[model samples]
Target chain A: MAQVLSLHAAERRQLAAWACDAYPHEACGLMLGVSEADGVRVLEVRRARNLNVERARDRYDIDPADYLAAEREATARGCELVGVWHTHPDHPARPSPTDLALAWPGWSYVIAAVTAAGMTELRAWRLNGGHQFDEESIEEADPS
Target chain B: MSHIVIRIPTPLRGHTAGADEVPVEARSVGEALARLGELHPGILERVLDGDGQPRQFVNIFLGSGNVRALDGMNTPVRDGDVLAIIPAVAGGGHESGGCKTESPSGTDYRA
Candidate 1:
């Protein structure tokens, strides 16, 4: 039983495009949304710069300032930063070992897999109460 | 007295009274941090070990360069310089419910 994440179809495409644009390197961003009884709903996406220039191939450091600013904006909009999204070039759409260690509970972690051929897949995961990442299902919703 | 801006990372901002960037007057990195700790109690314990040295997981940057590359704790400061206190972002090294925390060896600090 995986958690569900309701995201706008347009935003889903936008994130995949961003991942493609950063081909050969990892791209990351912040997701602002609300948590419902069943899962989470993504209302907005904020792109972030990957400051990990030295190891963009296997690691990403989303500018903390960007995260802080997005959180502030989400607060202003009556929503919360419910998750983070990042790309994994030529890697599987699964949370890596490092991802498991850095992830905090109760937030969705959406991973996009991009390669020279473009984005191959996108998936989401959430840290369970036991601190292990459980696969999440993405529900692309039509814009309201 | 130079007024240096200390940028607080998200994980440690709760100890800063919710301030992201705190400005303080001091002459060096060590002095500025000591002043910051005075202004916001309980922060020093998070970044410093019982020996008063920066913990292994904590990184202090003066401008774009790491303080370790310059002079460690004795790194000089100038007016308008930015001092960033960044916690090492790492995970999966051990099996724990969450990030690790260690209390100052002999201090009664809670953060």
Candidate 2:
């Protein structure tokens, strides 16, 4: 009985494209959306600048100013800064040990996997009550 | 005693009596954090570990730059400066999954 994350197909492509473009370095962004009992609806994707130059391949550190700005923007737009998304070059779209160690609860975490063959997978996860990651289903809506 | 503002991120707001920004007067970052802990109990423990060193996951920013990049806790503070405490964030796998739990470090996320 895993939770679900609903995003538009276009937004999915956007995330994949951004991750692909940031190959060899991780790209991160904020998700602006609404959360409900049934699922989370992603309304927009706010691209953030990754400042962690030393570990761009597997790690990302979003600028604090950018994070604040995104939060403010989401508040003004009647949405919440739901969660963060980062790319993992040559890695599977799963929560790494560092990711779990640094994770906060209550926000969505969408991870994009980009490989030499290009963007291969995009999945989402949530920290379950056991303080471990549990995969959630992604429901992509058709583009209008 | 120079008056400075400390911006508390949402996750740490509960420790500050639900205050987003706390105004305190101190000469250095260490003094400010100390005064902040005095004003609100159980806060310094969240920012600093038992050895009085800032936790590895916590990032403190003076204005737009990280204090760690400048001078660690010894970074001097002045009037009108803003210090922000932002802990490392992770663990959302779903866009709307209600994983409203504390971080793996066992830090309380009651809010």
Candidate 3:
């Protein structure tokens, strides 16, 4: 059976806004409180430098210290870092090669693509051990 | 011409009228994207900059590899090549202190 991973409508809107806000430069951040029973919950969002200065692409580092702190906080809250997300400017929201190599097995990778027309496209994926991508769908609900 | 698949995200599905994936053909990534633009009309600006280069936050993958390490949008694709686009996700708590020491580059956390 295929497992479905999704984001709340409010969270989806927030992520879309972030993707557009961090335009031109790739935005990097993490998702917190991912639970199988509760589904994926998006927590904090952070924007980081691409670090790939030469190519000006979307490479990221979560400030090792900050990353550890996030892990500890999640553990304390009995949550898991179940998913990771990023932005794609002017491209469809999908997983890239670096995304595949960087993605950890069992984690959901989310990508948000921002368009020149000021639109945001969000998609999710899972990386197989063979480094192949399995596309996941996002079911959106009316934002109340 | 080989067909390349462009996967659409939910948020942007309105642009494709909720179509999850669209197929296009071109010799290079740019041409393929141009084909995508022809079908989608105004999506190119969203994925590319005024200079015709991919935006900084967006990452393009040709098959299982990142185009950045390759020739970027110029990377060649044959029939059945799957191109995946990934955007950046940000947001998290910052460390107050103690954990501020920078580690050497290239350290794998899981190793």
Instruction: Report iRMS values in order.
Output: 8.0, 7.0, 13.3
The lDDT for every candidate, in the order shown, is 0.76, 0.76, 0.58
* lDDT (10s digit) by residue, model 2, range B3-109: 99997765566687756679999999989999999999988877887777677667788877888789878899999998888766532222223234444365644
Q: Write the per-residue lDDT of candidate 1 for residues B22-107, one digit (tens) a residue.
A: 99999989999999999999989877777777876567778777787799888889999988875544221112243344321222
Better of 2 and 3 by DockQ: 2
Query: Which 10-residue window of candidate 2 chain B scores lowest in summed lDDT?
Result: B90-99
2 or 3, greater by TM-score: 2
**Candidate scoring better on TM-score of 1 and 3:** 1
Give lDDT tens digits, candidate 3, residues B1-111: 778887543333446775646799888887887888899976666566667776654556676577778997788889988665544332211112222221111122221
Model 1 / residue B31 / CA error / Å: 17
> Mind giving the per-residue lDDT tens digits that candidate 3 earns over A1-95?
34456566777767777767766656656666554653454554434344444334444544333443444455577565557777777767766
- Which order, best to worst by DockQ? 2, 1, 3
Docking class of 2: incorrect
Q: Can you tell me the CAPRI class of model 3?
A: incorrect
Model 1 reproduces what portion of true contacts? Answer: 0.12
In candidate 3, residue A26 scores what lDDT? 61
